[model samples]
Target: MRSIIRILGVARDLWPTYAAIVVASLAVAGTGLLTPFIVKAATDHVVDLTQGNASGIATVVWLAAALLAADLANTVLTNVSGYLGDTMAARLRATLSSRYYAKLLALPQRYYDHELTGTVINRLSRSITSVTGFVNMFANSFFQMILTVVAVLAITAYYSWPLAVLLAVIYPVFLWLTTITSARWQVLEAEKNQDLDVAGGRFAEVIGQIRVVKSFVQERRELEVFDDRYRRTVRTTRTQSRYWHTMDATRRGALNVIFFGIFAIIFVQTARGVFTIGVMVLLIQLVTMARQPVFMMSMVVDSGQRAIAGSRDWFAVMAELGERDELPAPVPPTGRATSAPVEVAFDHVSFGYGDDDAVLRDVSFTIRPGERVALVGESGGGKSTLVSLLLRLYSPDQGQIRIDGTDVASLPLEELRGGIGVVFQEAALFSGTIRENIAYGAPDATPEAVVEAARSAGAHEFVSRIPAGYDAEIGERGLKLSGGQKQRIAVARAMLKGAPVLVLDEATSALDSRSERLVQAGLDRLMAGRTTLIIAHRLSTISSVDRIITLRDGRVDEIGTPDELAASGGIYAELLALQASATTRDLKRLRQFDIRV
Candidate 1:
């Protein structure tokens, strides 16, 4: 009940439409009740015709006309009420969808990592449909049922108060039964929804990783997993359906008995001459009309229960705390001054994921403006975690990170992020044209600037060679392009952003020799005059960096110039020696296959 009220509160702006629907519903009910009275009057006029009264024919014609008019009013009002109900439902859906989308954007990255995409999508879809169903049922069925009962009871009382009193007593009993049964069914329905969510999650996971499944030849295994989940969903749905069917049957039987009782009471009254034949017919029709609302109660209850369940899920997501950025609103940039290199400092920063062991502990470092530094460490040495902290993707557990002598947390999120550009090992591209992807960070970038950035990144030649040049559509995640092409496009995008700080995470680690050379040249151009941090496995890429920071066990083990580190006989020197040995082995293998031309 609280969930229903809260859901309605979301559509408060559409109260006028709801009001109109209520008025129309009452009008529709009023006309329907008048219909039986007109019928009763017409029947009386027919009976009077046996006395040879000519005026009875005219009276019957007038009564017939009134009945037709009442039917016409009922039809028109019913349609109007339906239209209004639909309008309110549409408004409610729009409000909820917008709110849900905003909530998703505001949620932290950690939330997404643990939540299944299919489960979230399914809940959102179901919530929208269920809320709409609830609104429609409330207006057309619930409200109409109330108005219909009241109108029927008032007219029946005019004929026979005792019969009206009896119906009033029976109505509450049916309502109570429906309410209790619906509450129990809701629990089962919720269980069924949970099963469906699990099935949907598995289906989405399998489809998204279809290539991996095929490569591993695990099609049969995946099919079996999906079948198991689907069977569970089916079993739960069947159980809920059976319960609903039994309840519906019981409700109908009870209503049928009450209907017979009302008919019998009218029959006895007429036999005793306590009522005329017209009154008897009228009472019977009214009694029959009253049964319709009671029958409709079951459907209303079912829809209401489903809606409540869906709204609970919807509100649960909305209630979660969103990502908090303490930064203030951004101040407009002053010309050319905003493009200066950014000096970054980490002041004894410490971080951990949950209560697990710290990923970074009391780490302190600084890079002067325009200095190029390389972070070298084995996997799980907290290299990426440091970068993520700098990007404010996750905050440090202790200490402050400052940029250009100002705490990063003091700057607006848009301002801080807008000042830095990144190129990851895997170039993440959306489904769009090459131009759109390049200008994503700077949507309003001029065509000339985009082309210039591409030219600098060494992408213009290849881009021009394509049929549509920069306008060409790149398939999902730019899968249509080769590794080198995707990386160059990513570089071009970063260049177009023209941020003061650049972070390259193993940018050329996966490319062939020819592709790596081309990508390296683009990286050189991109890193020019910018404060750059490079994370790479290949010593060749970082040999000329201003300094090297080697990490061990979440702490900085050594920091020095490449040559300085090599002469010190430390971790950096050992890594260089290992690479040299690998290179010597490769040359020896080449000599084994040599042939003079």
Candidate 2:
């Protein structure tokens, strides 16, 4: 109910429009009610004329004119209300959609970690569709329906309170029956919606990773899983429908019995001359008018239940804690000017992905200003998690990460992230042209700047050979490009960001020797005069780094210059030994590192 109330609060912003809709709806009901009185007068006049005691045909003609006027007013007012309803619905959808989208963007990354992409999208679609429909239907007709029911009851009671009482009883009976069925109906709907969400999520995942599905030859199995979810919904809905319609029939039966009793009295009295035929006719017509609203109440109740469900889902997302950056958005950096290199520090930092098993434990380190450092470790040693903490992708559970002595959490995200550029382990590119992906965050980068960045990353050669060059569209996730090509483009993207600090997460791992050599040369030049953190298992990448930080078992095992770490025989030295080829020069280098023969 509070969710519904909040939706009404949304209407408060456009009160004038909504108020006008209500007024026009009432007017429509008024005109509709007048038709019954007009018919009564015409009937009375016709009776008088047959007895040759009425005024001439002028009376009949005037009655007909009055009836037409009421109908014309009904038509005009109904259309006016309908137009306003449409306008209100459109505006409400826009307001609701904008708020939902803003909430999605502001939500923390952890929220997405457990959710499916399609489930997130499907919730928004279903919620807004049902909510807007409910609002529009309720505004356009429910108010008018209530007015018509009231007018009919008032007019009927004037002639005979008995019929009015029976009519009044009909509504509460119908409402009570709907209430009895509502809880079960809602339960079924929620269960079915869950199944639908899972099915929808799988549908999206399969499409996004179609290559994997096809390569694994599991197309039929995937289809069966999708079908199974929808089938479950079908069975649940079947039970729901049987219960609802059975109750609906029971309500209708009660209504029919009540009306039979009311009609028996009206006709028996009219035949006995207890009332004029015209009054009896009016009573019957009013009863008919009231019946329509009573019938519509059942439909309204069903829609109301569904709307409540959707609103509950919608608000659940809105209530999630979002990233805090109350300050206004910073404009994108427009020029090549960079921040002076700043020292980065991790102070006894520890973190985990939800569970108690910490990925990084008491990890403490410092990168001096403008130093090049490499993190090397065996798999599952927290090398990547450290980088994620540094970028504020995830916060450390125990301690603070700082840039130049200021806590990273206290710095605005834009300022913190804007000063550092990263090329991730995977080249996460969207389906767009080469130019668009290269200049992703900086959409306004000139062609000359984009070309210069591409050339630096050794990507300009292949790009120039393409018929469309920078304009060539890469398929989803850059599928049209080879893995090496994709990696080069990612490097080019980071090159264009040109931040004073750089983080490369195995950026050259996809390239062949020749390509790696070319890209590494470019990276060597980019590292000059900039603070850089490199995460690598390959010995070749760390050879030029000023220092190496090694992680083992979620703790910092070693931190030293390349030669010092090599002679210390730590994790970095172990990795270099494994990547080394079994040649005299390689063995000599390993022996030099003090590794046991």
Scored by TM-score, the top model is 2
lDDT of each model, Cα atoms only?
A: 0.81, 0.85
Candidate 2: lDDT over CA atoms?
Answer: 0.85
Judge candidate 1 at residue 27 and give its lDDT.
Answer: 84
Across residues 401-425, which tens digit of lDDT does each residue of candidate 1 receive?
9998999878767788778888887
Q: Which regions of candidate 2 fall more than 4 Å away from where they truly are?
A: 10-12, 50-66, 325-328, 334-337, 581-597
Encode model 2's per-residue lDDT on 258-314: one tens digit a residue: 888888899999999987888888888898898889889988888888889998888
Query: Model 1: residues >4 Å from true position, as ranges?
Result: 50-58, 324-338, 583-597
Record all residue pairs in model 1 with backbone atoms less than 3 Å apart, i.e. clashing.
Answer: none
Model 2 sits at a Cα RMSD from the real structure of 3.9
Best by lDDT: 2
